[model samples]
Target: MSIQRELIETLQLNLIKHKVILLFGARQTGKTTLLKKLLTSDDDVLWLNGDESDVRLMLQNQTSAGLRAFIGAKKTVIIDEAQRIEDIGLTIKLIHDNYPEIKIIATGSSAFELKNKTNEPLTGRKLEFKLFQFSTKELVNHHGLLNENRLLQHRMIFGYYPDIVNNLGDETELLKNLADSYLFKDILMLDGIKKPEKLIKLLQALAFQVGSQVSYNEIGTLVGLDSKTIEKYVDLLEQSFVIFKLNSFSRNLRNELKFSRKIYFYDNGIRNAVINNFSPLAIRQDTGMLWENYLVSERMKRNHYDKNYCNSFFWRTKAQQEVDYLEEKNGKLFAYEFKWNSKKNAKITKTFTSNYPEAEINIITPENYLDFVL
Candidate 1:
């Protein structure tokens, strides 16, 4: 079954405007699938894979005429894994500069490479989009609202990756392979890390500490690396879309704990795979952590897809009062706490409420989370 992605309309609009569209995501998140869906018989499309030496060599030609000859009147050119092609940014700049009528679509799994290559050359000439693993809203679109409750547990455990959601095969093995193979492939291939095991250990430690403040020195000690190296690995992991960091939110409160950050995985299944834990929720001791991670990630997808511009943080103080999620938009503050049980309710701490009296606070339980996220 083909699940239509929301980015198609945006990509089509960009194509009509003759802008280069760059689609980025983690490996196997359906970037190529999205591009294929946008292609049709009526369009004159030239498809090139950066992994191919011939394609790389053809695009490496520095002259505008050389690029024009390679394109040869093709109305559109699509490059897959474009970051692998040497001098791709310059090549793309030449093509775009000379052929104003040509449309270009490029897809890459690694942002560190692509962004560095294209940022300067394609400045103001490109539209960038991120395609995440399936979102709760997308699932609702596919199966309707009736099945959301039934699938919530599965989404929390197995995650919303396209292939995993579509397949009925062993999800554990699939997630294990994803964690073992594709999760760090870009990091290992692009960054010259001598000990991959250290990275794995760092990820495992992070998996166990989700929703909690992380200290670089502490993680470094646990993973047998220096703090600087630990920070670099974490940054690479975030760039690869495996995880994200949320910084502490402080507004000049002396008790506020600043300079600390919390880490969350982009998908729950990857987090579980790193920790080797996939037991049922009833038997799981970290269910609250799972729920917090799941909601935060889903909300992130929602914010991105809806183009909601906001700054996200987690609020904490020296007295140990905290809020699970904090979002500031248009100079207004919105805070939320996630509770796994529908009956349980979380209240805004008096200190937080008093300090930011203008901020709005809400508890997001299972019964009301759909409206909050979708």
Candidate 2:
């Protein structure tokens, strides 16, 4: 199944020779695959892999004339794993500034490394985009809504990573491999991680606490690391795209919980694999956790692809009244509650409604989830 990515059309329309296009995504999320689909012809494209020692050597410390000689008549240049190249920002800036007729596209799996390298040199000179796992809308477009709704159970367990989606029936093995090492490769390679085992333990601890506010101090004590170190590792994990942090939403309320945050894995399969549990919904105790994670992850993808900009968070008060997910856009509050069972009655608490009278309240159940996510 060679389904097209939703970003292809936007990327195609945004391509320009003067400013570079930077694509960032986790490894195996199909950055290269999307490039293959977008670049259809190789006639005038100069493809270089930064992972190659020779390629890195050739691009090291080059001047405008040097680059011109190297690139010779190529109209398009793509450097994959670009964060591996030292001073890639300067190199890209040179190409963008010197060659007005050459189009430049670079890809990296680590946002921290890539953004650190390019933020200054490429400021105001590049347009950036992030590609994530297959979204529900994309899947439905490829097949149909009925087929996708039928596969929801499997999706929550197996996730939507390109390879996992393409290779059905092998999700456990694939997710296990991903969770074991590939997801942490970049984080582990960076400095400041003295004990790697503690990092894994911390990730597992976070995995178990999905859909709830996380305390760095508690996780630190449980994992045998200090809170500062735990926070650093969590930030690194988020930048690597394995997980994300959602802060508590608070405004115009005296009892609102402030400065609290929850962490969630970007893909449910990775979260389950981290804890080594693949039980079905009937026998599982974490079905609600999985449902919340799936809904939030899909909504994030939809927001990014659709260019719907909003500030997202989970809302809770010191008194424990809570909303599962919240979004603030155009100065209006939108609160959501996620329930896997259609029979369960879920709604925003009156405390929340009274405090924010103009807010839009919604409950997302399995029967009506398509209206929310799609």
Candidate 3:
């Protein structure tokens, strides 16, 4: 039931140098478990939960003595649910300024809260990492028994949640409950969101619209919310790691559908739950949606952990020609298309190639997608 996070190696190296590491991800993605595994060797590791009263009191007090009293001489401090404590940014700043030797690792589910509170204060002091549900690579390496085909098949059904993997009984119901209890609770309570039902409607709409161009007006009408509210909700969901928006990639801008963006759920398991339709893969209608979401999320996790700060998007044209994923990095473009079948005939657009002649194109099929994303 243990997954050896490769980020542990990166964390060990970062702690030897950096003052802080901010870990953020969706709920139940195993942020605490990863930190627990990392802090096992450090005898002085101090764990603080923002939900606890004593921990909140210590974090709110700005005095250097209070900070020192809480931190003590611990070489490493692990803060769980850091967003729960108000003014945690200043607290982290105080610790970073006063105790340069102390290495801090903080995790939170809400990036909007975490980043807004800490990004400016810990600008130069913090290294950020996004923990995601188990990736195919991690699952393969850790379990040592998942065949590629079987993994792909299971992924389309149960998804890659840590708890879902650990407790293999009725994963559909388990994931549905987790999504409701974790993601639903966190995202619905955001500021100024008076009605949480709209958020649920928006998520359901997005779940069905995977890999398709999304219209704000259409979404607003369908969800019974305004365009501005729809935009805000989408941003909140992205911040909370519930869904992702991928823009259309263009260079020359001719015949490119630049205004339209494609949306994908961060986890297929949750998407199914949101829609309340966990159909078996044998009779499922949205296999393409599952594949697209799984591939994009896996690549996102790999790039995030590897610290590859590349721009990612989808490519499509007026003629309905499209590429599933586009990665832009270091002045070059890489185009990718995801297909469940090993069909070699991907409708590459003339505009895409002409504008970015140096770009390379690859087809990601079930058999070889791991090398493309992982």
Which of the numbered candidates is closest to the native, going by highest lDDT?
A: 2
Model with the higher TM-score, candidate 1 or 3: 1
Assess candidate 3 and give its lDDT.
Answer: 0.83
Q: Which candidate is the best by TM-score?
A: 2
| Counted clashes in each candidate structure | 0, 0, 0
Scanning candidate 2 in windows of ten residues, the lowest lDDT window is: 183-192
lDDT of 3 at 105: 84
RMSD for all candidates, in order, please.
1.5, 1.3, 2.1
TM-score of each: 0.96, 0.97, 0.93
Give the Cα-based TM-score of candidate 1 against the true structure: 0.96
Identify the superior model by TM-score, candidate 2 or candidate 3. Answer: 2
The CA lDDT of each predicted structure is 0.88, 0.89, 0.83
For model 2, the stretches where C-alpha displacement exceeds 4 angstroms are none
Provide the lDDT at 299 for model 1: 94
Off by over 4 Å in 3: 145-148, 343-358
Instruction: Point out the higher-scoring one by lDDT: 1 or 3.
Output: 1
Q: Which of the two, 1 or 2, has more lDDT?
A: 2
Rate residue 25 of model 2 by lDDT. 87
Name every residue pair that clashes in candidate 1: none
What is the C-alpha lDDT profile of model 1 across 1-374, one tens digit per residue?
A: 68888778888777788678889999889988888888884448899999799888888856998788888868889999899998788889888988988889888888888888899999999989999998898888888887977888888988988888888568888998888788656567866577888988999999999999999999999999999999988888888899999999998789999888999999999999989998989999999989999999999999999999999999999888999999999999999988888675568899999999999988998788898779
